[model samples]
Target: MQIILAATPVVLLIVLLGFLKLPGEKSALITLGATILIAIFGFSLSFGDTALSIGYGVTKAVFPILVIILMAIYSYNVQVKSEKIEIIKQQFSAISKDKSVQVLLLTWGFGGLLEGMAGFGTAVAIPAAILISLGFKPMFSAVVSLIANSVPTAFGAVGIPVIVLAREVEMTDQITLISSHVVWQLAVLMFLVPFLIVTLAEKSVKSILKNILLSVLVGTVTLAVQYYAAVYIGAETPAILGSIASVVVIIVFGKLTANREVKDSYLNFSFNQIFQAWSVYGLILLLVLLTSPLFPFTAFMKANWDIFQTNFNFNVAGTLHTVGIYWLTDTGVLIFVSSLVGGLIQGLSLGSLFSLLGKTTIQLKKTVVTVCCLISLSTLMDFSGMITVLGLALATATGALYPLFAPAIGALGTFLTGSDTSSNILFGKLQATVADKIGADKGWLAAANTTGATGGKIISPQSIAVATTACGQQGNEGVILKKAVGFALLYILIAGIVVYLGS
Candidate 1:
């Protein structure tokens, strides 16, 4: 009965958002109220501790996670206001005239690149918009963009998702272990997705059959580079490096298979112009790589940056909860500073850059509210032991078949929260707990949660809304959801099988 009541808030959240279609912010608030009530009365946690836990959760959400979102979106907005985005699109459209090949290059290759660079719906929104403008059907463009967005998401935003997961599990030393497990768990999807993209874009099997070798090449290069990076370089660099490497492979293959009779569309932008436009991302890549653990000065910088750090302790009953904020070493700062320098290099005036920053803040205000509330509620559940109870119940129910249901739980988290990072926050520890109970590999199980969250990207209401709104297909979200939910389930099923067999 206690566990059942513990699940009430989650149930209410799902029903409110999934069934009644309540706005996410409103649903979060309603569910948060329920969680606090349950924590105090049902779980017998002290009201003060529950409140402090909620506060801690909000701080974590704002600092680093929301901070990264603000910088990435601001940088993207800066590019848009400067018209560099148009040039970027013009360059991609120049790649090829064959719609199938273009789909592979733009949606799969370039979309993966964007996912690596920014990845807070930027991957889906930008690529879907470009595909629609390039003459693809609106719904098809949205589906392809969402599917491709899944490939690089675990390492999105310079690998913040895995970073956050590692922090939650309190196993920073095992970052390499967790990353390696996630890479292998996601390996099958990495190979399968390239072919799926081509098949989805082109309806006929004959068209897919013709492009089989090209699809295999894209998949092979992406997976190989991604695996190598995850093993050697750590999480921060893999997505960007892998995506760039795959793009090179695709180009080489395209040239080899080119029909001399057809002239490819020449890029309207000159080499210098292209360089200036993409310099923003190049700068961010450099800064992130320099500050990563692979560098010598990273430890020195982290120790010296204590001035920007925020640390606090709040007692939760007999226990103490500590929240540490490492501002200087945070990825948000790196991306924001890089954005400033990159904007200046691209010639945006200081005044215009600040203007773009202000606009970005305004644009994300609602998102800020939604994320804070949801994360706070999730933390409250965790502190009150509701999440653990639920995980125990799940493990008990599944028994020998627990592995098959693992990815389903992960998919459900993302479907509710619409963020792989948030899904990890809500469920990462739970996965670790269940793994211990079921005698499964703990690191791999924790990674299964994130890998499963990637599949939910397509059907996530937040993602679909971004894709449709960007493509001017607002009311067509239903149609787009119908198209994507199948692939989302397929991805989840495949992920479950991989985890089960590997275990």
Candidate 2:
């Protein structure tokens, strides 16, 4: 009865958010409130402990997502307000404007680039907007962008997941073997992304053939660069290098392909025109690139001041670790710089930027509140031992079926918690613990956790909010989540099989 009651909120949330057509922000809060009240009474969690747990969970879940949300919406508002985004779109138009090419260039190339550079929802948000503007169906555009965003995510933001998973989770008996194997499997998965895109477009063979050549070319370049970086130098540079390499490849090839007919009109790009892409992004590049540890500049920055990271930690499964990293120097700094540059480049006055900031703050109030409440709710669940008990229970129930169900649990954790990093924190230790108890390959279980968590990033309500809002489908997050469920489940199952066999 206790277990059944403890499980009620999560099950209700899944049903409400997934099938009942309940609004996202509303459903999360309602579920959270009910769970907390239940915890206080039915679970016999002392009010103080329950409150503390809620505080901790919110801090853990909200911190990472807060960074993503502010930066993302701010980035979007800046680009849209300043017109730099418009300029970027215009440049794409000077070339081929085929909706499909638009998908390939923006959703596949630019989306991967963002995932490589920024990760989180920014990858989908920015690319989704571009695809919507380019005339793809809105729902289709959001789904395609979400799917494409995954290919580069394994290494995004300098391979955050790979590094953290290696350092924090015991994914294998031979740590090196497990780490490298996980990367390899993800790389193998990358090969199918282009095929997935074509399949999403209804599998037209003739159309597939046209894209097949380009797809292989694009995939090879990205996969080779990513794999080599992961195997050599380090994981910290794969996302940056892979994405930058692919962007250059696609833009060059795309321009050349369209140049024949467009040569006399808008095809010619001067140095000034080339620099145009950097307007909204120039300072962002400086902040993330220079501040990245894999770069020498980050070293220089670290020497000057505390490298601007805010660390937050809490007890998890009776253990503690540094699970939260706020790169105040990286993307946060970029947001400030973007506001300034976006204003200047777009010709907005300083006063206007401030005014816009004020308006944006007000505009995003509900979003901010919603995120804060969700984080607190998730944090409460974690600190109260709710998330751990739930996961361990599932692990025990699945038993020998763990391989098939392992990834789903990880995915489900993040689907509720809203960020993969948090999912890792909440469940990583438990995954390893379970693996040891069962005599299963602990490392394989850990890898399954991270890979599975990645799959959920595309389907999480938090993710849906980010993508839908970015795709201009705000308040319709339920529709988007429903639309992507098929692909997401298939991906999760495939990842499960891969982990099982590899293990």
Q: Give the TM-score of candidate 2.
A: 0.87
Q: Model 2: clashing residue pairs? A: 54-380, 57-379, 58-375, 58-376, 58-379, 171-443, 172-443
Candidate 1 on 62-117: residue-level lDDT in tens? 76557766676666676777777777766655555456677777777777776776
The top-ranked prediction according to TM-score is: 2
lDDT of each: 0.75, 0.68
Q: Evaluate model 2: give its lDDT.
A: 0.68
Q: What would the per-residue lDDT of candidate 2 be over residues 39-58, giving only the tens digit for each residue? A: 77876777766666666666
Candidate 1, position 443, lDDT:
85
Best candidate according to lDDT: 1
- lDDT score for residue 224 of model 1: 84
